[model samples]
Target chain A: MSYNKRNDGRAFDELRPMDAKVGIIKNALGSAMFRIGKTVALAAVYGPSELFPKFLQKKEEGLLRCTYNMMAFSGSGTRVKPGPSRRSREIELVTRNALESVLDLSECPRAVINVNIELIQTDAGTRCAGICAASMALADAGFKMKDLVAAVSAGLVGDKIVLDLDYSEESFEEGAVDIPMAFMPRTGKIALLQLDGEITKEQLREAIKLAKKGCKQICEVQRQALKEKYKTEE
Target chain B: MGILIEDKQIVVPGEEVAEGMDFLPAPGTFRDGDKIVACQLGLVNISGRLIKVIPLEGAYMPKRGDVVIGKINDLTYSNWFVDIGYAYEAALSMKEATTEFIERGAELTDYYTYDDVIVAKITNVTKSKSIDLSMIGPGLRKLQGGRLLEISAQKVPRVVGKQGSMISMIKEITNCQIIVGQNGRVWISGTEIWQERLASEAVLLIARKAHTHGLTDRVKAFLESGSKK
Candidate 1:
């Protein structure tokens, strides 16, 4: 394998520049915006309020609902669309499940906590960024959480594991095995793990190690964002 | 196995509180195998044989007999649906609405109309999560000419203070009629607009700084400053 420089100039083990902030949108119980290089997503949490369609209400636990939308202009190609496409719907489920694992939804048995994520701009890693930001917004909204669900996506590019794939590397025509993973950093437990393509078992083990390290670093940024949001003078 | 976390220490959801069968689990914690785990992020409260976590913040879970301020959302011939700022709308039946016999064919709006704020007691919460409310109690009435405000339901306790000291002080100083619901809705009414404004600001200040120390003094000082202006 040749060690050639990637287009974005990031090393195989380097992540794109990340930025995150909480409480960006008012009127939300909690809000956060997260950016991964060119990929940007905003997440807002509402409720612990009410859930709908009466019959779906769970007696044992409340619902942690999520809505994921990618704006029409977020993509590089043509304007996508305003509504939720199948891709965004799948991302919504992924985000909600990852978040529910860490939330104490049973605290409010008959209500729901709504998490909304809007992809403002996209290059890659929108879903992972959304999960990271949604968890921060949940903390900012002051929900007791087991830990932030810090997520990172890695891929096997040319027989090497890359930390976070940019748009170009993710959609490389030669094909790559994309792995998106989420972890509850406090417990160091896996919350989400998805593999898009095949990789050798040995390579998969190595990829997880890199992803876990990346998630740890991402969790630090999330904690810092919460600290900034609640930075009160001692 | 022994306790893995210190008493009064904060733990996030899913964090282990104890590692053995020697300890008894309490609210905010559940048994996971032989270990005791926290179900919510809260400060661990340990008492002799019981271990529980006290959550610092979250939405209110309404229960029976909770006195909540609700808004009239929908009205029918037999009942009124009121939104108590939660998942279930409290149902106010005509029988529980007023002591006076609401005769047949009497317009339901004669007693209360749409958007009217009413202070009611939660009578029953059914198996399907329907809330039943009644106004047949002292201090429960239709709010008249008062401005309503809301804060995080979890912060309501701080606003009320120790034995109503904080709220009573605000009420006495501002000469305002103040009612604080456990669900975090406050009603501030005064004879004058200036008095109402001062009272509202003071309450908002309390809600904002509820988690901090010496909040009573802070609210008193804040009100004093506002009176000067």
Candidate 2:
């Protein structure tokens, strides 16, 4: 398939328009709706509540449960899987850890936090995007978080390492190995890291830096959405 | 109060971004090397550089002291498990659900059944996430013969505003009794159907455009224009 030109015709580093809403779900402890260009995600945060299995219950902190799903019609091509898959499981773990890094779990011992990420639309970098959306949703739910978690994906296409990978670039780019990473941009700390394909050590370092930059930008959007959601409070 | 940036909203502690710097995107030291930059502020830690913003700590957290609006998802054994939009279902026992002592053999459907909207309180949240709800509170009960609209839960506070300012504004204009469920379900009723409809529309508008600037004027204008003819 032939590739279509981007709207701005800018080089690969630029990002598309983003729309984010915090606490979109009425019932969840926290929830958020995030849209980046054609890709969209709805994330809900529930927890600091009782744990189910007696053994699974922790005495030190709350347990984090994350479920990531892409609706059947959320993507193009053959469509996404209906139930949870290995890919979904991986995404869930990554998201859970990313969120765990920022949350103060000690406040809710023996409790659990359930984060559900629904991909309403799939463009690219869904895993990283999902983590970012889920963290914002968690914050919106008013959970005690030490910091806001942010994430972005970068890939090596040809000789260039692009930030915020889109679907077309992820599939069509030659020798592309996508790296979806989650980080707390404020602390310059890594929460979750997964790299596919291969790159030189220098390229990997560059990729991490670029990914951090992208995550920082995404964090700004999350912040903006929260402000909009809560501005009326006195 | 926080700063509003280029119509996009942002919140920072008094020490983070100065008053003027927050109004413009990328107006402060965050600019790229020699590149004019614009970005909204997200978080602000004690050290001060822009960070991800966390919500202000509040008292309510699906607790026993608050009021909520919820929908009934299922009914069983003279009890109704209502979906209050919380993580767990709120079990409204037959006794707490209504004044009468509902027996085990009673027809649950005759009382609050599936898909019914109710206003209730969290009587207890078990260590295992099981929530016990009560409908016997002052304003708690089954919402009979009315429609419930769901909005984003985070926007509930904005719609209600500080000290019920926003809600009072809508009530004064539409002349309707609007019961706001902390969980984001709004129950609006009025003698005139059109008035109730108008108020619902107005509340939804506020929910959508709450992030925009000058919301007070915009909402007042919307209510005024809507009430005319």
> Which candidate ranks first by TM-score, i.e. highest?
1
Pick by lDDT: which candidate is best?
Answer: 1
Which candidate has the highest DockQ of all?
1
C-alpha lDDT of residue B53 in model 1 = 80
Question: Each model's C-alpha lDDT?
Answer: 0.82, 0.71
lDDT of 2 by residue, B1-229 (tens): 2332322235421113324332222321232232212222223321233423322422134656557888899887767888776545678877788887776576778878777777898888665446788988688877776557877655677789889999999999889888888767799988788888889998888876755557778888988998896
In model 2, what is chain B's TM-score? 0.71
Candidate 2 runs further than 4 Å off: A1-92, A103-145, A148-180, A195-234, B1-9, B12-61, B73-78, B101-111, B161-169, B211-218
TM-score of each: 0.88, 0.60
lDDT tens per residue, model 1, B1-229: 7989998665655568898888898887878788888765456888987999875555666778889999999999899999898766789999999999988899889899999999999998766567899999999999999799998787787889899999999998899999988778999999989999999988888777654568888899888888778
DockQ of candidate 1 (2 decimals): 0.34
**For model 1, what fraction of the real interface contacts is kept?**
0.32
Candidates, DockQ:
0.34, 0.10
